[model samples]
Target: MKLISWNVNGLRAVLKKDFMTIFNELDADWFCLQETKMQAGQVELDLPGYHQYFNYAERKGYSGTAIFTKHEPLNVTYGMGVPEHDTEGRIITLEYPNFYLMTVYTPNSGGELKRLDYRQQWDKDFLAYTNQLAAKKPLVYCGDLNVAHQEIDLKNDKTNHHNAGFTDEERADFTKQLDSGFIDTFRNLYPDTVTYSWWSYRFHARANNAGWRIDYFVSSRDFKPYIQDAKILTDIMGSDHCPVELVTKDLI
Candidate 1:
């Protein structure tokens, strides 16, 4: 089935910018959204044949995520079962008969690394959560993870080396996540492809194609061979980020 993930930046804002048009065009079996930036009741969406699930931050107009799926899940979970991490509404896991699908909006380390420590802790906790889930069944995890894993991921490696998303510590954390046996579907499928989902809103970064490949569709090792395709839909626009998509048959 087709699955797509996009960090809409702000769901409410994107809604006014033809979000529905793209949604209709893509026609994905499942659409996962990150950084929705709105609390409950802030926006109303009409998706005729999809079942919707949303996790909103307690703070209004802040970090949030939602999933729209044509196939209903057997069970759905919000957060990582950790209060500190759950409060941000950064994750949602949907359990099906065969696997678990998780949509995540990883926290940024902040411009000056002010939140680096918390971000590190979050990485550890999220990895642990994924591991536990993997132990139960195969998994497909996707979203804007907010980290550039290597020099090849961003345009100016030397200049961005010390930035929050490209810091040694953050990259190492991402490496650790992959080392734990999850496959980064996109990178694995197109080893030489070098596009990105997110770019700086300032500096006309997206227009210039100066960006980092921070979004992903990572799956458990056992399911890697089933990954039919992984892509970065750079042509689409609504938020600072474009969409990243993945395909596999019988997602359940």
Candidate 2:
């Protein structure tokens, strides 16, 4: 099976762009999105043969996530069971017979590290949640995690070291997540090959290839063997983030 994840930034806005064009071109078995920024009934998507699950933030037009899958899940859950974290609609988990697929939009540690504390709590809780699910079944989780985990993950590493996504606290949490038995699929496949999924809208970043690899498709250790390959579709564009993908056989 083929799976793709992209942070459309805003689903409604991307609809006017070539979103559908790329969607059709990729033709993935599962397509996930982050930062959808819309409430229920705000938009209607006609995706034939795919089941769509969306999680909307209580604060409209804020953080959100959605997943479109050809394979129906045995169960679908909207959050991590924590009221504070669930309020943002940042996560969606789909449980299958043999695996659980999750898409998440991790909270950003805003400018000046204003939300770093909350983000830390989120990381801890989110990691615990995935680990709990992994204990039951192999798992594949992806989306805009909003952290440049390593110096090699961004172009201006030294300059942006302390930035929102590059702060030590944030990067450390990411490391802890991996240490807990999850594999960063793309990095694992292309160890030293540097590629990025997100770019700043300012200073002609994308054109100059000055960006950060903050988006990912991570899987539990048990699911590692099924991961055939991971890709960063940097060429396809609709939002600031390009799509990242994972290919595999029947997960069961």
TM-score of each: 0.98, 0.99
Worst 10 residues of 2 by lDDT: 243-252
RMSD of each: 0.8, 0.7
Candidate 1 local lDDT, 1-252, one digit each (tens): 899999999999999899999999999988999999998887778899999999999988999999999999999999999998999899999998888999999999997899999999999999999999999999899999999897778988899887889999999999999999898998898888788888888899999999889999999898776689988999998899999999887665
Error of 2 at 210 (Å): 0.4
RMSD of 1: 0.8
Candidate 2 residue pairs in clash (backbone atoms < 3 Å)? none
Candidate 1 lDDT score at position 16: 88
**Model 2 vs. true fold: TM:** 0.99
User: Whole-model lDDT, candidate 2?
Assistant: 0.94
lDDT of 2 by residue, 20-70 (tens): 888988999889999999999999999999999999999989989999999
Local distance difference test scores for all models: 0.92, 0.94
